[model samples]
Target: MTALVEMKDLKKTYKMGETYVKALDGINLTIKKDEFVSIVGPSGSGKSTLMNMIGCLDALDEGTYFLEGTDVSELSSSKLALIRSKKIGFIFQGFNLLSKLTALENVEMPLIYQNYSHKNRKKKAIEALEKVGLGDRLHHKPTELSGGQQQRVAIARALVADPPIILADEPTGNLDSKSGKEIMDMLVDLHKQGNTIILITHDTYIANTARRKIVLKDGKITEDVEVS
Candidate 1:
């Protein structure tokens, strides 16, 4: 498998008042194309920090990060944003949908930044929504949908741009067990269909849904294993 993401000697620190917290301590990781991997850890274990670094949402204090062979660790914010928009799709636990926009509009948000025509954006958004089994709810607002449906919208939004990597941060955290299971199934199907999925979650069951599990603790990775 070709390497899609590579990190070496990654480090990050935060100043908490009079104290310094080592959020990430000399981390090194590599994720390959078409792989489904879960990063699991308890609270304050640096999972979120690592996610931010991988997603290009935050800069690391010291390290080299290569995404698709391009160095992204030292890029300017605008450059990083461009890289993120083109290569990475993000799904958050909160569903992050705009309350006033309908599902179709929300899914079209990413393309709007890329100078997509209105017709093209609408067409792609509809296709993505259909992929996530939300075609019938395209015009519904987030408030009108259930938590699961809202998450489907989020997934559609992430997929509409056809990004190479999907960064799902606790995607099922806000749903009931049944809904969460459905979301996990969708993610698994996505992985099979060639999307490189990086799932960040603390739930053991959710972590195991991926083919590979990476455990983090005290700002370091303690275990990296493949599941059968």
Candidate 2:
């Protein structure tokens, strides 16, 4: 089967005055459909750069990227936006929720962009919130919920689109241990349900939870290991 995501000799560099900083250097990777993978590294290790590349949020300076068999590096900006909307769901550590919107409303925001009918959007939002165990809290705002509950709202929003790939960056970084574990369990369940997940974190324990772990150092992949 073709890989869900493929990168070959990917490189990204940033210019700071007269110096050029390499964010990602010659990264080659393949993530299969429905596979749970984690990219872990410390600061300046290029984890974020790799995630940005895979998520189609940034264009690399060199190399090629194929998403679900299409060469994304060759796509236009408008096409890239369409592909991102259609293929990827993003979950961030900060919970990126609008302060004034209720959980249901926030989850419905993505559907709004997709031009979903109001009634259908509500139905899907409710189902997604419920999936994250927040059925009773749909009416609450982000400030009204606990940290874990807030993250759950973010997860619900990510799932609301039913995208094939879920990209979570430092998903548990802001939560307490109990809450972090809960979030991890939810991710594991989502993986079992056949959603391809790519997690980015600096935590070894968190990285180990995935079936495959890719370690990065100094903008290069240092190790790629599959756990049994």
lDDT of 2 at 141: 92
**lDDT (CA) per prediction:** 0.94, 0.94
lDDT of 2 by residue, 1-228 (tens): 999899999999989899999999999999999999999999999999899999999998999999999999989998888788778899998989999999999999988888899999999999999999999998999999999999999998989999989999999999999999999999999999989999999999999999999999999999999976
lDDT (Cα) of model 1? 0.94
Question: Which candidate achieves the best TM-score against the true structure?
Answer: 1
Q: What's the lDDT for residue 226 in model 1?
A: 99
Q: What TM-score do all the candidates reach, one by one? A: 0.98, 0.97
- State the lDDT of candidate 1 residue by residue for 64-86, as single tens digits: 88999989976898899888888
How far does residue 116 in candidate 1 sit from its true spot (Å)?
1.0
CA shift of 58, model 1, Å? 0.3
Clashing pairs in 1: none
